[model samples]
Target chain A: MLIFEPHIHMFSRITDDYERLALAGVRGVLEPAFWLGQNRTSVGTFVDYFETLIGWERHRAQQFGIHHFCTMGLNPREANDDRVNKDVLAILPRYCEKDSCVGVGEIGLDDQTKTEEKFMAEQLELAKRHDLPVLVHTPHRDKKKGFERCIAIVKEQNFPMQKLLLDHGNEETIKITRDLGCWSGFSIYPNTKMDPARMVAIVLEYGVERFVINSAADWGVSDPMMVPRTVVKLEQAGVPRSKIEQLVWKNPIGFFAQSGRISEQMLQQPARANLRETFDGNSVLRGQDPDRV
Target chain B: MSRMHEQLATLLGPAAAGADAEFAKVLADRSHLPVVFPGLPRRLGRNHLGGGRTRVGDATIDLDAFRPCDLAAADLLIRCEASDDELFDLYQHGDIEERTMLLRALHVLPVGPITVRMFGEAQRTNMLVHVEAALCDGDLFARTVGQPGFEPDVANRVLLKLAFLDLPLARCLFAERHANPGLSTMLQDLATEREAAGRAVWRDTWRMIGLAPTAGSAARLVGGLEHGDDGVRAAAAEGLLALGRKDLFAFAEERLPREPRADIRAILQRCLA
Candidate 1:
């Protein structure tokens, strides 16, 4: 039951959530750079956030036995802030080249604002220049429209559609994305996004080719266990175990491996976890005896 | 003559003589060339024509056996030396495949106001591949938006057409640059009309509601908070939160207890937070 959670914001989650994800069979996670609930006011804040995603967050995930990978971008919501966006864009080229950074993403539309689109286009070019895969975040509101807009932009860039992952899709957008020759991503959030039952139905309808299911768990009430939970639902619904494995594990690896960073062997090899491991002066354990555990 | 031969002659014009010589040399040793008709999907049945063999001038070409890379090489040779007018002319009268290839080669073309005009014309047809090539490939649309003569109505039409066709906005060249009040209002009207007709509006329709934040739009967002679909309600809550509408605070507070989903509740909490 090894799993790969394609989209999650572990920076906002508690340390315990990582353990829970690992216990539930999530062997790897790719946390896309996204907006914190409050808008960031400075480029320095974005820089710090990007650093943490590749640095501290990667270390943090390792302690829970999960191999962490991330995609770098100025999130669509924050891209609207002209003040910080320019600086963020300026720094993106450097960060996107990081070893642990898999691709340029969660970059797409939020309000579909001019600034957001401008940054998205630039980031898409950045991804092209780097020859990396893109993890696109479709707007949560007008999702169908957002997905359409996202695909149009990806095509306009002449970026390889096969290398693109259109994230946060619903039933309505799946068929279109699949038809367009891009990978379709479904985030099984507890409430706002697709539910587990709905995900099972989508797999049944769409037949799981280049289809990926993720948690996209962030600061909100999103469940980190959404992937594993959906797996159980799919199994109960009579989906073959092989198909389930493709959606949960293989498909994501295939998509991210386009970045030339991830490999099957890397995902298969277990990352050694030391509960006593500390990032900077921070530890996953606080006052709890590591030896006892 | 083979379609490829004719297309090459049109693309090369005076240069066709030298290119034909190169094509002949390449044809003699076909191992290095790519498959002429790449394994396109069965769904693209129309593209599966001209297979097996064909005649071009004195050459007896094996159309089915050409390398895909050779076609790419031919396109590159033709486009590398072509003028703006020549490229545009070819695009204007080219077949679907040629037009698609020309659009893909837009980055190499000497694009200008005339090229932009051509793009607008192609966009009007709403052909998926042409629309994609015009809007997706180069900065032509972005440049067009920045032109002094650029019309908002035209840009609005492009955006609306994208929604109508269900094309991904991610690739629309001017989508970010042209996210103006006019477009937002148009989207709102479309969403409203669709909802009234009991049709599902594009999800991006809520983005306009969030962006403009008018009293009417706010009211719509508030209405969305109570909508039957959890996704709609959550999206509405997000819009309301982004708007920072203090007036909607009490309304959101009242709805919190009755909110069945924790994700929606989390969004409502953000509105107050």
Candidate 2:
């Protein structure tokens, strides 16, 4: 009955009230590193953010007994800045560890800018380098071009399609990307992104394999509880419990836990409060031992 | 009297007018040209093509202008001398490009008799099919609507309309719409407000795309750099550069000296540069 939120930005949100989500049955989460509000300017800025993802954020979630994981990348907007872009890209390799790090993600396209295209190519290289799964960001505008370009560049680089998770996928983009054999994701926002109702429709149409949903809630009006709400919605819609489990739990664990960041044994360990835990030491709930959490 | 002749004279500059489809066939026969699908859409201008086209100063030619040739699997490629519009015609006719700019220009051409080749991941092989221009546009357009931030109405109004107009005229029209004494200043304030409110990424893009040129936008951008978060600082740098304020270069430079993060320092350098 433990479900995982494969994508969310817990730090971007004030999830003080998310303990209710635990009561509802969410057991783990994977927060892909993404642009917070606008874009991050410096490598140091990204480092701090990345640290929070692997550190404090993970700890914060554990207070309620939820396991936390994250993926890192040079987001599209930040990729536009050549100065910080290279620096960030350079650091991505180091952080994309199988332990603690889940995959290379939230990288793809934004604005469909030439700069974005260039960075997209480079980040794909980084993904290949780390042998980690890639989380791509399809641009909000000119999505056809962005999606087309994303496919084109990946094919050009000869990266394995199975390792790519094209995030922000909607009906059209998901169909195409999934057809191309890349994992697909839909972000559930209140209005701007996908909703649980629509997510059900997509799963019904696309048949749920290589498909997942996320909150992507960060620095905006987002629902941290949306993940479990989606599970509830799926149940109400007549989707089989097995199917729901695969989408919310097994799939994410397969993709992320394979990175060697977390093992079945590690994930099952009970939560413990420790003295050294801080935003710097651990991101989960304060004083929780990550080994047990 | 042939379409090739008529199109060639205009596209390839009168000198290429006499070239016929036989020449295209000959070239296709001799070169290791990839197969071209002729059923894709073309562009709206002289470079109008089905797939892609090649340009000759003042004139463009279609791949059909050359003689068709036989080729091997590895030699599978398509080359066309055509306008953007005409090349789109070739694409609609079932042509594809494996070479750079071999098919240039064609964007909005109607689908005709020829079939186009599409590569499918499932088969991992090229599949030939005929798709009409309108259908291609519709397909791509529909897919775009599902993307994160595509607003066809807004994109059409802003990018499409402005495509034909000069920058100055576009700016004037922008000014007239707001009806404020300090239209530039007002727009800048609006952009700042939007950014501060934690607006969705798409909303911010549409609002700021036009106003990035205003002095007010630049001022706010400069002011935004000092905000607490790195995301804000990065966005401010981007906005300042978009505003074309060279003066901000010095300001950016000054901050870089004190910046502790390697990535932030790099962004500041690019902005200043």
Candidate 3:
């Protein structure tokens, strides 16, 4: 079945990872804009990083037959920085309007600071203005409180639950968001977070309705192949193939398609792998013969 | 209507004329330029309005380097006689596309000291597209070429940055025409630095400096012709062709018979043509 990786940081992965993803039947990948494992000193870096997501990163993904899309926002971690927080929020409107930007994202509570809450509420409004969905990055440290605070900000902003994707979810958070009318996202990892075996258990219990899975792989020891691995475990767990396909593909699109940019019809097409085509005269070919490749 | 108004009206047809009027009403408030700028591309359609030229300070920069909606956004700012302060503020805070258009449209606006800071804003970006917008077509660097007053020599910095980013030198349409001895020296130094660092130098480094070849770059043009790489040979021939450096092209012409690559042969044939 074709899989849509809903949250992997392809920017942090190598080109071989993209090849691996394609060989593993992953069709499309959504790379949400997030911090690069550390705080950026300025908004200039944020703008540059955002441009990479929409520009070169997208070009790089297409070369490997992956349909790349991204959500643009200030992440939860950087929301507390006095230097870049408001400036990032200041520049996010235009980024939200970019064609490949499917949502405002990675923009929920991390440390659960009042400043984080401020920017989360602000970006929730930013998404509403752009008519885009959101991918909220709940805290890795205090994830339970992070999920609650993220949900509270979304609720207090009166943001539609249908458009909220509370990502980095575990079994405990699923219990919170499953009946809350929002999409719940699980990141299947190699060792930590939710492993494939654990994700299979979640799928068995949650039944894949309004549910999504991703690698959430980034500048860390994470697996880009976790989604495909989870599909295997789900298969062995007696989860039907059609339901697995729905979980891997349809559910993510159903949530993000609220942007009117992405659709089932969009990802249904083959990846745009015209190797000779250059973005500003730099193709991924780098001098390799396209035909031979 | 101004030339931009006429061009946009002609290109966009009735839809563009209506947009101009709609924008004119918003321009009455003036501050609405930033508020309405980002959404124009979606509202106006992104069909490139085609290449046109405008005097940005001392240089005529390509307007088609900008998107149609961005051109319209720039035109709106121009229509309101947007002061340098306003343009600076918009450019200071504009996102990727916004800043790119602002940089590319720098030629259409009146040149001043404020533009220098705006130039710094483009330089500050780690994104190549932003730098491309400024130097390649913004004519911001072209304005600083021999004219002086701009600091740090952005013309050379942008060309080297283009190499660092692996974007083509062709993006900067006037790179060869704007070629200067300082830029040639800078390009040669960069080539040496890359070689020492065990990195491949930019293919077009010699090409950009071919017009104003320093001793090192001039020698590279000769060496590049006999280089084992077909792409290098083709690039060397093309560089000589641009410079009308027939003496250098003679080497490629001699090696043409032995050249197996059809692409390189085509360029070599053009060298003596």
Each model's fraction of native contacts = 0.00, 0.00, 0.08
| Overall local distance difference test of candidate 3 | 0.77
Interface RMSD (Å), every candidate: 23.0, 23.7, 6.4
Query: What is the TM-score of each predicted model, taking all chains together?
Result: 0.52, 0.48, 0.64
lDDT tens digits, residues A130-238, model 3? 7889999989998888788888888999999999999989989998888999998998887888999888888877798999999999999999999998899899999
Q: Worst lDDT window (10 residues) for model 2 chain A?
A: A273-282
Model 2 — interface RMS deviation? 23.7
lDDT tens digits, residue span A1-293, model 1 = 89999999999999889889999989899999998999989998887887788667887898878999999998899889877988888777656755677899889998987777788899999898878899998998888888788878887888888989999888888768877778889999887889999999888987999989998898889899999999999999999999999999999998999987787789786666777545544666778878875
Model 1 alpha-carbon drift over 4 Å, by segment: B1-273
DockQ of each: 0.01, 0.01, 0.09
Docking quality tier of candidate 2?
A: incorrect
Candidates 2 and 3 compared by DockQ, better number? 3
Proportion of native contacts present in model 2: 0.00
**Model 3 ranges off by over 4 Å:** A274-293, B2-7, B17-38, B47-273
Instruction: Write the residue-wise lDDT of candidate 2 on A131-241 in tens digits.
Output: 677888888887767788888988988988888888887877875787787788888888877899999888777778888777877677878777778888999999999
User: Cα lDDT for residue A210, model 3?
Assistant: 92
